[model samples]
Target: MYQYSEFDRQFVRLRAEQFRDQLERWQAGQLSEEQFLPLRLQNGWYVQRYAPMLRIAVPYGEISSAQLRVLAHIAREYDHPDAALLAHAQATQDELQASQPGLTLAAPPLRYGYGHFTTRTNVQYNWIALTKAADVMDLLASVGMHGIQTSGNAIRNITCEALAGIAPDEIVDTRPFAEITRQWSTLHPEFAFLPRKFKIAFNGAAEDRAATGWYDVGLQARRNSAGEVGFTVKVGGGMGRTPIVGSVVREFLPAAELLNYLEAVVRVYNRYGRRDNKWKARIKILVKAEGQKYIDAVEAEYAAIVAQDGAPHTITAAELARVQAGFVVPALSPAGIPSEVSITAKPYQRWLKQNVRPHRLPGLSVVTLSFKRPGFAPGDADAATLDALAELADTFSAGEARLTHEQNLALPWVHASDLPALYEHAQALGLVQPNIGLLTDMIACPGGDFCSLANARAIPIAAALTEMYQDIDEVTDLGPIDLHISGCINSCGHHHSGHIGILGVDKDGKEWYQVTLGGADGSALSGPAMPGKVVGPSFSAAEVPDVVEAILDTYRAQRSSAAEHFIDTLRRVGHEPFKQAANGARHAATERRSHARQAEAATA
Candidate 1:
């Protein structure tokens, strides 16, 4: 975890105060909504379907118990149904409706007191109130957390592999670079307003846990023959309306010149990237349009910047050392060694196998607390759950916990000997689902339920599927299946990278889901980096489960053995078999319902 310096603390406090002042002016009608929109967005506030959503950056998803406690306090104080914040939200909604009589307000859902974890490793409060927005910002600032640059057409939160430092195969502890990037990109004057929102990811490990290939700009830490650390920079990769894996703009960027190289890339995009249409504004579209010419231009821009700056913005050993010092590796105790405490529960054993991984330290283990419990929306945790996690972090993980891109929480330094006790405690908190990469372990975005941009409700589908796949043995049997759903084509759920991807679409004002097959993350062993291909025509939300079941069934039938993964089976067998099965299952389900209705009529 990065500790805030006096300067950092003051900077955030001042920024919060600035937002507070801006809020007062906007509310007083001193500034038009148009004038206030960018300001609010820059602070990570967005007006969604029912209420405002504030996305707080977790800075590579590393959070201490103290910070988590602050979030818990915020949720308990502001997000509860009986909280004054809800009243404020209702008043705001009422005011909007009063001004525009034709507006139909969506009914609010029951209070769950939980903030959601996004695929970007950030936490979002989807039901924040306009009145309490500033207060919430101030509270987050108290814990050195903020939502700044989390939204709008600016550089978003810098993310890295959640297990960066702990991963055994890591070439570099990416926390230093990730923190450095956060510092540089935060409130940057030059790239503040790009053509579109830019996402950057750093992967310091042997495997691409950070999904570097899917981000706007990807930097993979590497070493030269001389054992010098550097980065392999890739550019222009993104998902959404157009999904393209990034191209290697610079094969090996010297670690010292990282910031300069980044500046050059941003400068090039700012200069030539599309601005006329929001749909075509992403750098991927620009890169696609210009092809090799764009890469050449970026290289040329890099040269010019280097020449003009006299030397690139080189990082010194002292600066790197200072940043590295912020990350704390807890001292190991001999008590952390694994114990031979006899037999355990079967589910606990499964959880240990699936959710626990070997940490870089011999006696310590990294434990993933599953958030994909059945009947709950994936990546969601109530305030109470968060508080429990905060306490658990203090007790087990050295008071620090990391959030994964998969929307789960990770205790990166759990003593292996304490696994049984931790498992019992986690089970009590409804956090021990024992499903990490199984079929039930889903990644979904808030669709029509919260986000105004959604075409359908993604949470419902995720919940329904999770419940449907309640047989953990069956789910595990399916083997390492990545099921992802998004309310729309924004790819916020990273649907394009799931083994079974579901994208919600609007047809005749009704929700329809498009299914994609063979989508896998860059760390996938089965194939190359690419978006999942749509299997066939879209299906209704009701038909989604059947379709998903059919796909799994097909995979099971085609797999050579239990050892073969779902993705490998899909790639080997292709989509035709799965397509046929999906259609057949849907038709059968429809027919069965119709026959039951007919039988009831006959009885009557």
Candidate 2:
């Protein structure tokens, strides 16, 4: 965890005071909604259905025990949702109407200020019963935090690989560079307001853990011919209405010039990127509008600004050393020897195998806490759990816990001998599920529930599919599978990389979905899932289970063996067979009531 200096602390405090004054005026009726909207949004406040909700950006998804405690404190003080979600109605709208005698009641709207720590997409604090949002900003500033740059058409949080320094395959410790990038990009006057939001990711290893291909700019740390550090740059990729996987612009970018080159890239986008339609404002659209050759040429010209005009940017060796020093992976009771490795030696070995990775030191490994396990909300941890993790990290992991883009937690420096004890503690805390890399582990975005721009609720759909594939031992046999779901076309869930991807849409004001197959996320296995065939209009919760079951069953019947993954089977057979199984009258979930209502509705 990076400690705030006096400069940071004072800056946040001043910003808080400024925002508090602004918000007080708004509440007193001096500032109109129109006057306050952009100012509050820039400060990370949004006017939602109920109240103003503030989103704090956790760049590259890293947070400390102290920070987590502050978040919990904030939740306790601000969230007004203690009176939420107790009255149980039918689990599904269909279940309530037919099974029980007809009684109609509007489901109560859910409560506010729920703290959801999601994998990589964002962490949302549903805390706005705020009559004074600016005051909240001031409070956050008092704690050395703020909502700055968390929203708006500026450089968004620069994301990086969760396993940047931990993954065994990494070429360089990307954490250092990611931190540098975060600081450089934060409130940068040159980039504070851009044509649109920008996203950047760096994968420090060979394996694309960061989903680099799907970002506006993805950098992979690699070694160049002169035996120096550099990156392979992928440009113009993004997820939105038009999702495009970035193309490789530079095969090798020297470490010294990476930042300047990045500046150049931003300059090009800022100068020529669209300001016309919000939907078409991403760098991807600009790249599409301008040929790749032209963009590549701009980068080359800017390379001099990087290597020569070099007032000083990019990660210098000293800066790298300073940043890495903050994340010293702690001196654990023993960094090299985990305390209870033998406890998880058998059934839990898979957890250790996939979830844990070797750190930079001699024997220390970075242990990942998987939130994507069966039955758990992806990236969600309650207040107690958050506290326990903070305690464990402080006591066991050198008091450091880094949040992942995947919305899980990480204790970066654990000894091999201490693994079992940690595993047991984790189990007691409801964090021990061995489903890493399995189909049950899913990546989804917060669809319509919280986001203003989403089409459907992605979390429930993901939960449905996760429960839909409960028979894990059997599903494991099908091999590696990635199923990404997005509320809308923004592709926040990385649907294009999934072996099977589901995108939620609205058809004529009716909720419906489209399914795509054959998409992948790697060099060996990367391709678009074919455009989805529309499915369901107001499909019952019961129907969702059947739809997933049909897909798995269809795969099992055609699969050569359990060794074959979902994508392989999809290509081996075709999408039509699965579609038939999902939509055909033979399925009990869909037939009770036709989904015809949605098809007749207007385009979503």
Evaluated with TM-score, which candidate comes out highest?
1
lDDT of each: 0.84, 0.68
Residue-level lDDT of model 2, residues 77-112, one tens digit each, is: 676533332132113323322332111222223433
lDDT of 1 at 578: 91
Q: How accurate is candidate 1 locally (lDDT)?
A: 0.84
lDDT of 2 at 332: 57
Error of 1 at 12 (Å): 0.6
Query: Candidate 1 lDDT, tens digit per residue, 28-61?
Result: 9999999999999999999987678889999888
